[model samples]
Target: MSTTPQRLMLTRTDGSPISALVVDDEAVLAEMVSMALRYEGWTVTTAGDGASAIAAARECRPDIVILDVMLPDLSGLEVLLRLRKLNPALPVLMLTAKDSVEDRIAGLTAGGDDYVTKPFSIEEVVLRLRALLRRAGITTDDGDSQLVVGDLVLDEDSHEVARDGESVTLTSTEFELLRFLMHNPKRVLSKAQILDRVWDYDFGGRSNIVELYISYLRRKIDDGREPMIHTVRGAGYVLKPAR
Candidate 1:
């Protein structure tokens, strides 16, 4: 008897699986992007024009969208408008060959969450999708790996974090650092400990990079809230859920 292998899937906060729709006119490029995203474990679908892009999104109920700005049927901006109407909070990553500031502004103004100029690396595309998903308050996990301390929730599978149910965005580095701190909640992590675990490098006791990122995380994760990250003066930092 032959057995079938199971493919891993990413899920959102509500325990539903995450899916993505890739809209591009180039067949080769669309397949390549779909494969890359699927490798990350997201359900991936593709469409070559505006009408089909909208149709696919409606049919699939995707969690995010990757849209190419230049489409054979309609402009990317126009497609975004239609998609936004379908799902106001849908995160869209715009792809374009144009590198002008104006072009980027137009996309952003039209509800695109991010943009990548053409000839870009698929690695970067995947990373951007992760960040987009993070901002959208979604992540991948087996439903058991999600970390919750008070109102703060961090899903290891999705690499997503939310404090007090408010979505917080973090850079790639910042996200890693926050994850490290959250994993050891209420544990006084010395700067050395943090540096080792988060950066994997010995800064020879002379680097303030830890301080910088900690401050960055505080602004995003703690500012205007009952401080969760507390400094121990001479000791280190600790993440406490106390409000």
Candidate 2:
């Protein structure tokens, strides 16, 4: 039982697709973030340094920005100042390796709407961007926010899950796993695919971790009800509307 995953699309108040500018000196990191944003149905532009970042921002007028605190040419703070001049109310999220209290304070004081330290998960970045968009009065194209398959429901905005109208509490990791499965309902996802998407990195031969989390989901999502999550023998796993 496999099918194409439905794309979750978010757009501006005017119905135009949301856009983002990601500025990081690390080319790979910028690409990863861009890919994640595009997956959410957003248009993404990337810049590797402060000079190009400012230029791209001027051209694209992105709805939001993901800025790195350190850059080869200009400090992220300097870039932030320049960007603010372009759009005072623009939402900016700072990414820094500095996690000290003072460093965090500095980024906030410089007008960053949110701050994320290095070594962060891609999911965290996505979640933070969603919150920023919401606070800025942007919203999904449709009024709907919940992902539904049968009686199971997962609310992206509130981070809540319910099965047959009953709440199901899940740890962050479990929730990410379930969200991945739910995103591709009825699709047989291999262990490698799950590890890459859910974990956001190579798990290095740790397929058992996927099995463990699947069991955890089964306990919460399938227990005491017609099973919706299914294993596809050697291929992988699939989730479908329970019959």
Candidate 3:
């Protein structure tokens, strides 16, 4: 069975919906990235060239910009300079088809906050944007910053997890996986879904990684308490409040 990817509904620190500007000469890629950002509950604006990007940045004052290194008019570096002049603190994640280290350095040296090579997964783009947002001090609203299922609690902002009043230590990957499960408590999540959401890429038939992480979570979350994470016969894993 397939399930629609869940919307994160993250917001700006000021409690407003986060906004983003996507600048790519490739119309399809721009729209695809914009759609993913919008799915994350962000207001997104797309520009096909450097000129439109600058104009949009001035008008929208987006919280972040997903910039394409290659633009039809001015180079992405030039656009980055213009954008910095408008809002020096605005976070920018550069997208480049070039995977060369020098190319990456050029983008970073030109004041880009982060960079992702092309042919990337949408999940990777989303994950990188979230990290950039957090670093820029834009994060979930206070009311929506944590997830709770029964005795388990996960703090999105603090990256802390606790169960039954006891704090549980989790690695970054583990935290993300648990957070995904917590978001859809009681619903079965297939390994493919878990891989996409947590790893941000296809694992090429390697599902044991999910199993490994699930076992790690169980040891910490279910050890000496009723289990909350359970696997169905041949379906997937589900999290439920311990009965």
* Per-candidate TM-score against the hidden true structure: 0.55, 0.85, 0.77
Q: In angstroms, how far off is 20's CA in candidate 1? A: 0.4
- Per-residue lDDT of candidate 2, residues 140-207 (tens digit): 43534567877788887778999989999999999889888888888899999999888877677979
Candidate closer to the true structure by lDDT (higher is better), 2 or 3: 2
Candidate 2, residue 238: lDDT:
94
lDDT string for model 3 (119-203, tens) is 8878668777887887788785343456788888887767889998899999999998998898788899999999988887777
* Lowest lDDT 10-residue stretch of candidate 1: 1-10
RMSD of each: 11.0, 2.8, 4.3
Candidate 1 lDDT, tens digit per residue, 18-134?
A: 799999999999999999887766788899999999999899989999999999999999999999999999999999999999999999999999999998767567768877787
lDDT of each: 0.83, 0.88, 0.87
**Which regions of candidate 2 deviate over 4 angstroms?**
1-8, 140-144, 196-206
TM-score: which candidate is best? 2
**Number of the top-ranking candidate, with lDDT as the measure:** 2
Off by over 4 Å in 1: 1-9, 140-243
The TM-score between candidate 1 and the true structure equals 0.55
